[model samples]
Target: MGRSFFRRDPATVARELLGCAMLHCCDGEWLGGWIVETEAYLAEGDPACHAARGRGRSNASMFEPAGTLYVYPIHAKHCVNLVTENAGVGSAVLIRAIEPVWGIDAMMQNRNVSDLRRVTSGPGMICSAMGIDRASDAMDVTRADDWLLTGGHQVADRVTQTPRIGVSRAADLRLRFFVDGNRFVSGLAREHTRPRRDVLGPDKDPSR
Candidate 1:
């Protein structure tokens, strides 16, 4: 992904990330996953955004340049974020779910799950499965030097948006986006943000 890909508003960027591949190099082995669900957090106005209060220890990455990773933990579990918009703008796209595509065996082993969907279906699941941590907090996602990667794929009318889950403030905002019908997408099926035109089936690996 280029810096321009994340230069837009967090909501638009979140929706656009559907079907994009997250390339990871872990333990000297290449691993990949396709993004299926995302949630937008805006610093300027969103109460749920970590930057709502201002730049601090937890949200420092959110104030960094575009294409940076803003990873943090929630409920003692991890969730990976893509820092977007301008520096100090404090906007990020929360990668809420993904469909495991490459290094399936390693992902399965890391997650301790034989089922593919369960391996990286949720934010915490994908973070743990991907080995993302503070060490990668500010990694440039556009890098190809065996670090992070964001690759595009076809995602037409399969996207559905809804309110972000597990947050009390700004809970009703329809900012969550997902590839409809993707089995790896977390959350209730009935709570889809909007009506679906067609459900994009299983995820396919996007080649570099």
Candidate 2:
């Protein structure tokens, strides 16, 4: 991932991150998967954004430089966010789901599951499997060689967009983007969006 890529608008970065692989080095091993799903939280009038009110302790990292990690907890489950836009501007892209493309056995052990889908298909689940937590907050993802997005992924598949899930406010902004038809791309089971539409077409051979 380049600096310019993450420095763009939150919605653009969220959609463009559909196929990039999130690489994380753990215990001397590189573990991660394709970022199949994402959601954008803006700093302006977006009610779902943490900075909608203004910068504070809980959302200070959202105002950090682009590519900073903003990990937070909700209902005992943690979710990771990539800080986007400029410093103090307050915006980030949520890494909603990842298809576990590496370290299957380790992920299974971490998540204590046998099924692939159960291992790392959701935001919190992926955080658990990848050893991501509040400790990762404020870390610069762009500078971390071990925890950065890698290129060369060819996702020749439909990219779908819909309103964000879980937030009661501004839940119909169509800010969530995901790889259409990917089984491991999480959240579809709990949250359903009507009249979903495709935003991007396949560029090359998709992950499938």
Estimate, for each residue in 19-49, the C-alpha lDDT of model 2 and write its tens digit.
7878677886666778888999988879889
Evaluate residue 52 in candidate 1 and report its C-alpha lDDT on the 0 to 100 scale. Answer: 92
Instruction: After superposing candidate 1 on the true structure, give the runs of residues whose Cα lies further than 4 Å from its correct spot.
Output: 192-208
Whole-model Cα lDDT per candidate? 0.81, 0.79
lDDT of 1 by residue, 38-116 (tens): 9999877689999899889877989988999998877877888998899889999999887777888998898888887
**Cα-based RMSD of candidate 1:** 2.8
Write down the lDDT that model 1 would get: 0.81
Candidate 2: Cα lDDT at 186: 65
Q: Relative to the unseen true structure, what is the C-alpha lDDT of residue 16 in candidate 2, on a scale of 0 to 100?
A: 86
* Residue pairs in collision within model 1: none
The number of the candidate with the highest TM-score is 1
